[model samples]
Target: MRWLDADEERAWRALRRMMIAIQSRTAHDLAAAGLSEPDYEVLSTLSERPGHASTLGEQAAKMGWSRSRLSRHATRMEARGLVRREPDPDDGRGCYLVLTEHGLRTLEDAAPAHLESVRRHVIDRLSSADLSALERIARKLEEPT
Candidate 1:
């Protein structure tokens, strides 16, 4: 087995810890806005799309989630009147997850606080060089093997 050497192991551990810390802090910040991370993700995704709607499959793919998982979460959001599903006009077998007025309002309200939280937890903590290095690392990781 190819084991991580001392330097690699330290870097890996630091990366994991940083990610967990950021995620926890961000989640806590979102909770104050009356939204969870998943709620923010779904609402934001729909809001960014044209007509504020997307097919379940498309959204799931975009979010790197399973269709079933997104579908179940959509049901919960729908129950809360944050989103709604409509029959797809072009595809009889599929439906589009749409952002409702309530959803848009909720997202709009939460966005400012969310942005501040992100800046506080991440952007403000990093220098321009750090951000550039992070972006390079992210792009490298995202490249196909």
Candidate 2:
């Protein structure tokens, strides 16, 4: 395959740098909320549901995570009183994940700060045209090959 031209290479490098920068800043913001990146991710995933609960496989799928990874994280969160695991009544072999009261409260408190961080460090830096370009790029990337 043909390699990128100098300008394309520069653009690619800059995009990579931006991604790393945004991820680091977001992780730091979550850490300040007394949650690690993975913790926040799992909690956030559950929070999006109607009752803050989902099956282990559903959570894994939503986060593009492995079942083992979700299981390990769930175990730690359960020990910390942030979440609880129970057998799915509909399917004895399946497990259901529920966010505990503490998890809900923590996530609610963290949402504002996290949103502001994203706005300031990412969205605010972009113009409307830039945002449109970003959306187009993301859509293209998400499309099936």
lDDT of 1 by residue, 1-145 (tens): 9999999999999999998999999999999989999999999999999999999999999988899999999999999999999999999999999999999999999999999999999999999999999999988987779
Error of 1 at 121 (Å): 0.6
Per model, how many backbone clashes are there?
0, 0
Please, what are the lDDT tens digits per residue for candidate 2 over residues 1-145?
A: 9999999999999989988999999888878888887888888889888789999999999988899999998999999999999899999899999999999898889889888888988899999999999999988977779
Flag clash pairs in model 2.
none
lDDT of each: 0.96, 0.90
Screening candidate 1 with a backbone cut-off below 3 angstroms (N, C-alpha, C), the clashing residue pairs are none
Best by lDDT: 1
